[model samples]
Target chain A: MFNFEITALGNMFFGLTVLVFVSLFFVPNKHRSVTLYSLLFASLACIFYASDLITLFIGWEIMGWSSYFLIAKTADKQTLQKYIVFNIGGAFTLLGAIILIYGACGSFVYSELDFSAVPSGQVTAITILLLLTLFVKSGIMPFHYWVVDSYSQSNDLFSAVLSAIISKTGVFAFILIFFQIITVQYLQTPILEVVAWLGVLTSIIATFKAINEDEAKRLLAYSSIAQVGYIVTILSIMGSLSLEAALYHTVIHTFVKLLLFINVAAIIYVSKQHRFSTLGGLLYKYPLNFILLVVGIISLAGMPPLGGFSSKFLIYTALLEEHKGLLLAAVLFSSASAFLYCYKLVYGIYLGQPTNPKTEAYPRIPLRFYVPQILGAVILITLGTIPGVIVPMFNGILGSVGFEPVLYRGVFVLGSDFASFNGGVVIGAFGLIFVLILLFFVRLKNRSVKPKDRLDISYCGEVPRADVNLHYGYGMGRELSRIGLIKMILSRSSHALWQRVSTLFGDLSGITQKLYTLSAQNMGLVIFAFFTILLYMGVK
Target chain B: MQKGFVAYNNEQKSLEAETEGIKNSQTLIQKAMNWFSARSMFVVAYGTGCGAIEMPPVFTSRYDIERLGVVGVATPRQADIMIVSGYCSLKTLRRVIRTYEQMSEPKYVIALGSCTINGGMYWDSYNTIKKLEEYIGVDMYVAGCMPRPEALIEGFVKLQESIRNNTIQPGYVKYREDYAYYQANQEKLLGKETQPVYEEDYAGMNLS
Candidate 1:
């Protein structure tokens, strides 16, 4: 039987997917088949619009397979294997959870589930399985081994879809299941707290990884992981404010990634360079593209007079409401460090002197590329100027999901009981100051001269030869390793963390022995008494 | 050979003599601009020899040249003044020329110590250039074997007075008009082009 229903959360996600798909028309897909691409999109729709567990699973699997095929075209054997193994493993866990739910409830339909009949222990097991699946899909750490390889190795445009659209499906699934179907009251608070910490930790680690990466796409891939980590962290709070913040971030991140990826794609289109060391000083060469990238980065960093700040403001307020001071501190620390990578992304690509001489003659970007960038840029600016415009939509989602609507009022000004700011005033002030400075400089009698040659920079009176490693994109995050705590975070991979979990199981019996010894004097008697009791039990 | 800047300076001075100090032949706006430029000087002092040792005492809290509005900047492009601090060797002369060319117009140069004036210690050495003037224009010279920080301060004060009063020829104007002469001298000594040189009056000098 086919049962289809629509919800406010699904509609928002589906809308974003459509916006992403609209940009793809500009990109010429030369792949072996339009069939695979269509399948991917159709499956995405299925997942977003699915009414029951079965329908969702069917869509999820199709999306997975189709994307694997798409990525297989560009990615190497090892990357493909990594992609399939992790995704298949996640898919199996999802299937296992669905089967268990069906067995327990005797139905797969959304409205038909009766958790009252299910055993509490079985429900906890179900929760673990479901969380594991979501964690893998969203690239939460200790379960995020496959994300970076696939996103960076995939074709440029598809990687945008992977980050901006697909990764968010995991988030959609989370709300669809936890907020609507299962609800959070059944869940233990300790589980959610651990999830929140996992998310923030993921972001902090992924940020450092992003900065350490040299290849452009790989760095963006790491950045994508870090951003999704923030959403997951905030979502775990399960408050209306947290949900609004997560949704706002989701919307902003979609447009920001679309803008950045398309901008990078356009750069790669002309320059044929992928590494930051090879791509520098494109600011003048592609002025419009550079400005768009700057806009994207400004939003990415959550600065004021940009849409990013609005969501970040909401996220912090939500955390503060919960009195999650330690978690908020960690989240803030990660976000502050994020500025370094954001700067690296911009400076590595656009600002510095071009490492290659041929970069000067790189071809003009196609008009099609600007279509998505302009669309993204306009939306971002509008959101920054009038962030309150989308609140009613968010309020509608919250209402449909059975929660209280937040107190954000009006289009130009965002006001709540806790915090408020006028977007128009922030933008107006910024514009006025910029104009004043520009006018002052332009009216000066003594004009500032730029030397005709790019190599005219003073280098302690010595001229730099053409081959010097001027752009240190590879070395951007290397300094962080010198710090003690960061060094520990940077050295361990997700695989290492998982490996430790297995080792923990092997040490369980050994842990029992240590558990019995409370003090140094008791330790000697405890060990002797334990051995005697074991020997007496063995004889009996 | 004072045709370019010094002659220009005299024309303005005579015009000022008639206006007599109150108006001083300059518009109020022009006078204001001159006053601002003289008050804030960013210096790029290239330390090629012994005089380099004396700059720290001048710059640090002990002497604090910042009160006089003469601050040291790292790059030539940001600097309004360049001090050829001591003896200019053949190798050092090339960089100094390159840096001088990079600085914008309204720039001045101070050739420090007797070494730059007449090559005090390195005078008889093969690599040293004796007179700083032939290679590039010298706006003011603080004369000593290793000029005292006080002497250097005096040189800056004198330069600032000339800048504020609009009386003396700034070196950049002279370099622009007589670039060919400087380039020819540089090419004869260094045996290479130090920087990009556009077409100008040759000031044809026989290098040999």
Candidate 2:
């Protein structure tokens, strides 16, 4: 029998993200995609509404298989193998935790679970197993080997959905299982503290990886990992304000990724180029797309007058309120370094000299591509201008999850007991300054002279050969690799450990295969002798 | 001596007549624009040859060009003046032409060294052009094997004065009015495929 629960937490996430699922219909994908998307949508619904562990497990399996098949449609053999292996491993861990919970409680329903009656050892085991599943699904550090490949190799539009909506399921599960079911009082260990540091570390490493990336989508994939890392870090704090901040960030990250990924997709569609070296000076051709991307990056960099800044401000304040100074410092470092990659994203595709002569001859972007971008941009702006609009909704979700409500002063103002600010004032001030500057520029008597050709660049007195590359997009972050810590990080790969483990398992299985090489009669005799000894011991 | 003096006097009288015509036609707004343009010169230093070695001294501490409100910019879009230092070979001329066209309106060109004036020691060479003005307009020429930093600075002062008094038409205006003449000359030297037809009207050519 199917068991479902209507809760505010589930409604809040599902309500916002269902649009992302619907947007797939508007995008023109070549693969036979409708079935897989529908399967994904249905399974997500099942997981979101499930009131019992059994239903949740079933939905999780369906989501895994459908997404695997969808990715397999276009992904290479290696990427597909990584995706399947990691996801299947995560599923096995989830199954183990559910079995442990069922054995302990003698019930599968959420209402019947009693952590207090369970042994502390069993509780820790269950929590660890569940944490493993969540970590794998969310692509946390040391377990994020499969993420970059799967994200970059998938169909471009689906990649956006994977980063934005699907990744949040891990956050959703953490809130549900850890906060609502096990409760913080039962944790008894500092596992969450370890998780917080790991989250920050993942962000730091991933930011550098993002900076070093040459491929556009791969860079975005790394950025997605970094953003999710922050959410995981905030969730680890286990306070009401931190919980609110996590949810706020989840919503903002979703919209920001949607806008950015779709924007890049449009560029890729038009230019038929993915490497930064091949694309440049597209701003004049697609002014609207460029503006939308600028908006996306501004929000992503956590600058003022955007929704991203509001959530980021909340995250910082939450850390400050908890007196987590070093952790806050780490988070701040990652945020500051993120600007380089953000600028690279814009400059690689939009600004500077055009590298390929054919770039100017590329056809216009399809109208359908703009639909999702425009939608995401509109929502982001609304959230930026009036961030307080989502506070009441978040507070409702918090209440359903058994957390105290956050303080609310007005419709436009957001704050905790520590600090508060009005979104309207920030937006107003930014707009006023922007308008004044624009007016001053317009009134200036110095007219801008248009270049006669793309080759018309100041190259000293020497004329540049036609074959020379003027684009510095790829070279911008190449020097970061020379820094000591960044060099160490870039030199090492997490995949090496996973490869070693697999090799060890292969060797063990080979030893086991040697026993099967014996004749059938010899194998039967060996089993008979083993059973006789076991029976003798039992009788004694 | 009497005949040569008479001819020189006639040339001087005609030059004065031209200056009077320009002064009478100048508007107040044009005068103000000239003043502002002369005051703030953003130079795009396109180092074409060996003379580029001397430019570092002019911009850096030895010359301190910034004290006169002349700053170096990286891109052509923001530049008001381009300094083509040294001799330009056929290969370099392609880029120089592109850079010159890329610059914004009211742009001036300052060609330095004897090479740009007439190819310097590279005169009669197969690859280098003797006259730089045929390919693009040149406003002022600092004549030397390699112009000294002080001489370069002096050339800039003279160019600024010409801009301020509305006494001379900037080269970019001529490039706009008679682009075909320059284009034909550039094509004759650089082959037809050297530059792509840009998507804008230049003089009479509908490139789009």
Candidate 3:
């Protein structure tokens, strides 16, 4: 039925190849495995172009299992088990929902499935199931336990792949469900609204955890959760442009995470340290890696002239369109939280004084590692400079999904009918201003300013100790954890309160366990009492 | 019945009953004295182990032996109170020393639920302490773990009922002599030689 079947099959093979390769990374003969992983990754790029759901699912499941095995290969048995269980749970839910849809419409074909025929209840159920599956994969809150366990435990290289390639499966699933299957016009439930709120909550909670987490890998894992939360929120907007925003965001986040994780991995591999508390003053030691990390972190922080800003700006526009004032406020709050963690990630690792005095030479990264990171940075910068090229392809996808694709006029006007950003004007002004500043700085440069043995960072009278490590720990989020009404609304302390309620259950279960141990007849009596209560309620 | 109710017989019966009551009263007084002597006071040390390190400083010779009339008692039956200092680790948590039973009337409890107040440094630590009061009831947490010796003394001074009504008959041998149970648990959690290097008397030694 489709000429793209070869592409689909090739992609599926590549996905499997990547999975197999990544799984075997710990083996002594790892070069062949890396080759296989790259081959699979290349094939997956083809799979992304699949014409139908069947082919898509093949690629999808292959990607899922391959990543799962890869993650499993990296983690301990307990974490791997949780990773498998959580992923399988999501996959099965997705499979069941697909089956239900096929049963309702009597087709496996994505192009053939009619949206109008799906009964409201069935549609709602399918949406919920799909959303749940996707949320689990994305590592959204409450469902995020597997993410940290898997990401933090994985080999550093594999951690890069997991953060980049694997979690994007959630975004793919979201596109399929939110765009292809469900019509945005079917006005019924507050499901999307709930998702938006969930995103905000997820960001807040994950950021707090990220702030507290001592392990570098775990911190990155929490950060990934926070980013995915933003993506999910944008997708839930269900606007044509928001789809573009989501896709752009996915691309940006993937590259940024890949870059950051690789840089961190390089740092760890060189220093044999994984905790931020132990890592400091590396800017002087590993200048190139440090620069790469800064680029990645700044992009992650959504600073202007980077990839994060453009996509985030689109999401904000969508929110403004919907007049979601509170959500807009939350978006800003989460962004500020991003700044807090970003500062810690940079200042804690490189800017602060070295705690350990026994200095070691910095290890050079294999060209293989730096290439991918450099490619990612280049893509990020190019995307910021010229958003024109990919905007059309995303428009096509969103248009097919039944949302009006925004047509850009050189990254300024939308659809030739409306106006937005004026890239020419802004870029020209920015370039002129930059040149002037550079000229002034060059002219004002002072040769007399010599390098000091020690730099003063703090205002206190005590001279900056070369050995004392300055760490901004979990206490940074203390301001947000207010004891008042806001905390009552957003905090999960209620889950802890439920522990008290469960204590009652614990008491009851304990008594019951003891009673059953003492006599089976006592259990029979209990069952009889339960039936008696049921009978009484039935009569009433 | 009418014959038994004669007036002279009734008067004789009343006199005999009064004499029997007086004898019963004397026996009751003797029993009360014996019960008083037999009563052993039960105090929940609520020591929470690491903070229990500072207890010797207050009880030993350098701090003066008995100004407050309170001595560290081992068994709950021989103790009248509990002092919770900072941090409770999960492994050493069993010996927190809270008991609802065997305590005499007018018992008091203080909460140390903040790492026993709000899980201070131990909040994020999984294997460390949690809400201490949620398990064994505490009476007047001494606030800080390794609280200043002054604060520990202050807590003791505040607990006067425990001082004045010293009904607890502590076995001085057990209270003042042995430290096996505490040592074993400590050794189990942290192997032998893990007791901090600095002794209480070492003023010049640098401790991190």
**Higher-ranked by lDDT: 1 or 3:** 1
Q: For each model in turn, which proportion of the native inter-chain contacts is also found? A: 0.32, 0.32, 0.00
- The candidates' DockQ values read 0.32, 0.26, 0.01
Q: Pick the candidate with the highest lDDT.
A: 2
Per prediction, the TM-score for chain B is: 0.83, 0.86, 0.48
Is model 2 an incorrect, acceptable, medium or high docking prediction? acceptable
lDDT of 1 by residue, A1-540 (tens): 555788898899999999888876686544535788789889988998889998999988998889999999999987887678778888888899999999898899988987877887777777778888888888988778889989888888888889899899889988888888778877767888888999999998998888788888888888888888999999999998899889999999999999998888888889889889889889988899999999998988888898888888888988998899999998898889889888988998998778888986899998889878888888888888897678888999999999898847678776467777888999999999999999998997655555556666778777676677677666788898899988887887877665576579769968888777579878888789999999999999
**Better model by lDDT, 2 or 3?**
2
On residues B105-137, what C-alpha lDDT tens digit does candidate 2 reach at each position? 778898888888778899989999988888887
**Model 1, residue pairs in steric clash:** none
RMSD of each: 8.4, 4.6, 26.0
For every model shown, what is its TM-score relative to the native structure? 0.88, 0.86, 0.60
Q: Which candidate is the best by DockQ?
A: 1
Ranking by lDDT: 2, 1, 3
Question: Candidate 2 vs candidate 3: which has greater TM-score?
Answer: 2
